[model samples]
Target: MTEGRKMRFAMVCSSNQNRSMEAHTLLKRHGLDVASYGTGAHVKLPGPSLHEPNVYEFGTPYKTMYEELRRKDPDLYKRNGILPMLKRNLAVKNAPQRWQDNAADGIFDVVMTFEERVFDMVIEDMNNREQKLMKAVLIINLEVKDNHEEAAAGAKVALELCKELEATDSWEDTIDDIVAKFEREQERRILYSISFY
Candidate 1:
């Protein structure tokens, strides 16, 4: 809550390979403390295809991602999810579980869900007070559909929503903007929430 103190953010995505990974990379580039994970546990790389019945081969390695992140900004890695790796390096058992539980037990200042279903899941877990104090931002995915125009339109809507959210101080304003935009666009929605605990 102090000025210049980085906010702790958790990004929950349907898959950690593409959209969520890009967002996480961007946020980290901007010097925010962010950790991202997929809803499904231990999802294999080269995920299922959208257009065809084949799996997509373009995927990133988790360990390589971690190491690359650490090398880029050690502090970000330290505050994000790298502490658990450090513990593991020291031969600590339950390092992953400990770090994960610490993260989930109200450690994150904000929780952002990238997909609508994941957003709904996060919303279902929130209490009244937490909901009131929290900030939920939806990052609508443009790549879901193959149409370039649709993707561009979806990205535009998302940018507008983000601007509206950034401009207003009231949660109602955020909610209204989201609902109105989504209703107008009638496209697939990906929602992310940030909670200050």
Candidate 2:
């Protein structure tokens, strides 16, 4: 077992299809308490053309999307890596979850977003929530590209950050030093703020 109390984490992105799922799988594999979320109104994936994208509601099953995409154009989706991505996502969770819809979700110790806009959305959503518990959560943003390769790399960094946070007994007391050390070692600037749950 780990030394300190396990910190609950949330990985968030625009659609929760690629970046957030990538990080979620990695964190879960390492035995971390974690969940993934999207800030968008719909879960979106690339289509045969840029103008035409496949969009599904927040709770749409990944298996359903996989079957539909494969049936529609197996070769195209396979070539574009969407099939492989869907397979990974299916292994991690049942469906794409929207951040706004999950307000009732119990408090998370950390909420990490993959983009600036998404970071803004998460912060806004948290601010709008009715803070009954008054527990503090650190919301951090580490910009990651939506593509698979970048998502994988970003997930590794996220994993490292989570590890550091997990090692601490009280994150609220040492978060400043922890984030500073991370930014120095990883050579990546991070934007972060503390909000209440």
Candidate 3:
């Protein structure tokens, strides 16, 4: 463990509904300091058809989204897993937060993104920011599918990564070793870069 406090973590994905929330819940349940965000213009969920999606602003409450989707099509939403996903999201956080909006709230030791696009956005955002703290942060991209099953599996892998990271006091010094071990064991390649707060 670190000398001062536990490491802080952030999980990011496209809409912050499925993948990020899944990992967020697992990390939080393990008593790790963690937060999750979405790198999207708006929160989106699947609707009755492929072309139409249920889109809401960033600050819309999960309960409100759940009720609206349920009201719109109780059977369809339930069958498609949107209702359950919203309920799980409600348990984790009140609303979906945009990554750019919340990036400056505080410093995080590690920021994990679920997709390559989100990873790129996070890196760009970090590079654009004025580094006030000079604190080093590791931004890792572990591509996870947006679906429920893949999210659950990805969350488990994320939790394992956190466990390995927390085992060392100086993560920056040992991150490469941890990543190499994880990749060898899990057969999943991890893309990582260092940024500043």
**Model 2: how large is the Cα RMSD against the reference?**
1.5
Cα lDDT listed for each candidate = 0.42, 0.92, 0.90
Q: What's the distance in Å from true for residue 187, model 1? A: 6.6
- Looking at model 2, residue 150 earns an lDDT score of 96
In candidate 3, residue 1 scores what lDDT? Answer: 48
lDDT tens digits, residue span 1-197, model 2:
24768899999999746999999999999999999999998988999898999999999999999999999999999998999999999999899999998876777999999999999999999999888899999999998989989999999999999988898888888888988989999999999999997
Q: Please report the TM-score between candidate 2 and the true structure.
A: 0.97
Higher-ranked by TM-score: 1 or 2 = 2
Clashes of each: 7, 0, 0
lDDT of 3 by residue, 3-62 (tens): 534788999999746899999999999999999999899988998787998999999999
| Candidate closer to the true structure by TM-score (higher is better), 2 or 3 | 2
In angstroms, the error of model 2 at 12 is: 0.5
Give lDDT tens digits, candidate 1, residues 2-34.
Answer: 133234555555532333444444455555565
TM-score of each: 0.44, 0.97, 0.96
